[model samples]
Target: MAEVMADNRVAGAKGDGRFEPIEDSQARMLADLYERHYEPIFRYCVHRLFDRTLAEDVVGAVFLDAARTIRNFRGSEEDEYRRWLYAIATNHIATHIRTSLRRRVLLQQAAEAGRLGPHDEPARTDGPEWPQVWRAIQTLGRNEQTILTLRFFENLDFASISAIVGKRETAVRTMLCRSLKKLRTQLKSVFDGDR
Candidate 1:
């Protein structure tokens, strides 16, 4: 319990005070943060990039950036840290997409390839219908994909997803509903052999 309290205190301290902890606590917090959110962030990245390796790199970069900047973090009643962490993930994914056209092409190619290797597959979405579902998700605008990933897979509330994606909660909800409808339509077409 002391460790949790200390962590809370450390998180709440303002200015440079939060950076005062020795490297050990810093490392511990980083590790704890990774343990808590790595999978969700990775899933978000892979959903965006469609490549396991690049997704892993993006997730690593997100957490590394988080570790370096966490001292400036402010406290919140909700899972603020998790939201902040995912915001970093979202930014890293966007930057990667902007910087690497070839990488984006390769990722899209892999997604179209339909192999679903060991790691890149969505958990429950991996059944016979997965190919259609994934392809539909890939078709979404990047913002829609990011919001859907945060809302459905990460189980984040609309407000937190709005904060992450820089939209109003109502907009997030509308976009998510639209994205899902698009997916349903695409999946129906796929199963109907429209492709």
Candidate 2:
């Protein structure tokens, strides 16, 4: 059809000369995905980036990435699409944090202020500042930081994290455990009297 041709996303024609239906379905599915997933994705970005404006930019980039690569996406199930979107978000957040010192500083400040802690409990201001511990977190590799963030900050389980990160569930668990142990060691140094 003229509309399909006019749209550059059709990828290519089948041997029968019909535009790939998967691309069309993907487009439609993306529309629906935007309606359903936008808010949660925005929240994820906001919590991770600690700035509404920056989060907005990152969320827009995620969806734009989804649209740009929709034709190449082979997933037919909604869960697959959701995992794909989170994977995109993960990469964008990491890229944003790496490229923008401002965002990283903001996240560090937020963590220092206890915004990153459990909401049910208030932060213990009596203790020393958490910048040292967070600096140790920063020293971790990107994959380690990502695993920690997805598990602790986003509250995602190992299974979901494995799907998002394209790792085996056991690998996700091992990575998370290793990252946590490293953080605990840093925490011990920061709070010398504490375990």
Candidate 3:
């Protein structure tokens, strides 16, 4: 398509030899950013939500918000852009959790009022240790959960995570250390119980 070719041309062009509209440049940058960063963001969301469809929807929403705010985005470096995008994804996940909690509360209220029929019990897990680990992760405070997931599951270093989380590197390291210690303690108890 002509649009694709135009985008490619503008994207590959360095310096201001040719005049490209501001909108065109921003669009090209967004497309490039999406191509490079979408998978990592999607993985992060999937890890947080444990639902592929919801993760995909959240990814779409994250990019949509990024595109809208791209004009205000600063820093031309890849790492800075990554931090910005991850920050957006982090906020979206928080919103998703709040909404889910609100819905659950409303459903519970409805059931208590006798306006809804009884529902089946939640499913039980009978899988490997990873599922148990994930369940234990849910018991952590929100900050602890986010730090552990970013550090371990996403394989991000403390420096990058500090940027995404808006925390000092030292603070991030401290929280990560505390979170890992707590997680190890929790896992030990589970293994002890199994024996």
**Which candidate should be chosen as best, given lDDT against the real structure?**
2
Model 1 per-residue lDDT tens digits across residues 114-182 = 655456545444233444456678788989988888877778889899988889999999999999888
Which 10 consecutive residues of model 3 have the lowest summed lDDT?
A: 1-10
Ten residues in a row with the worst lDDT in model 1? 1-10
* Deviating ranges (above 4 Å) for candidate 3: 1-23, 102-128, 189-195
Which pairs of residues have clashing backbones in candidate 1? none
Residue 9, model 3, lDDT:
43
RMSD of each: 7.8, 7.5, 8.4
- Residue-pair clashes per candidate: 0, 0, 0
> Per-residue lDDT tens digits of candidate 3, residues 39-125?
999999877765567789899999999999998887799889998998898889888877898653554454344443213644333
lDDT scores for all predictions? 0.76, 0.77, 0.76
lDDT of candidate 3 at residue 109, scale 0 to 100 = 52
Candidate 2's C-alpha runs over 4 A off are 1-25, 106-139, 186-195
Question: Per-candidate TM vs. native?
Answer: 0.74, 0.66, 0.72
Q: How accurate is candidate 1 locally (lDDT)?
A: 0.76
**Candidate 1, which segments miss by more than 4 Å at Cα?**
1-27, 76-78, 119-131, 190-195
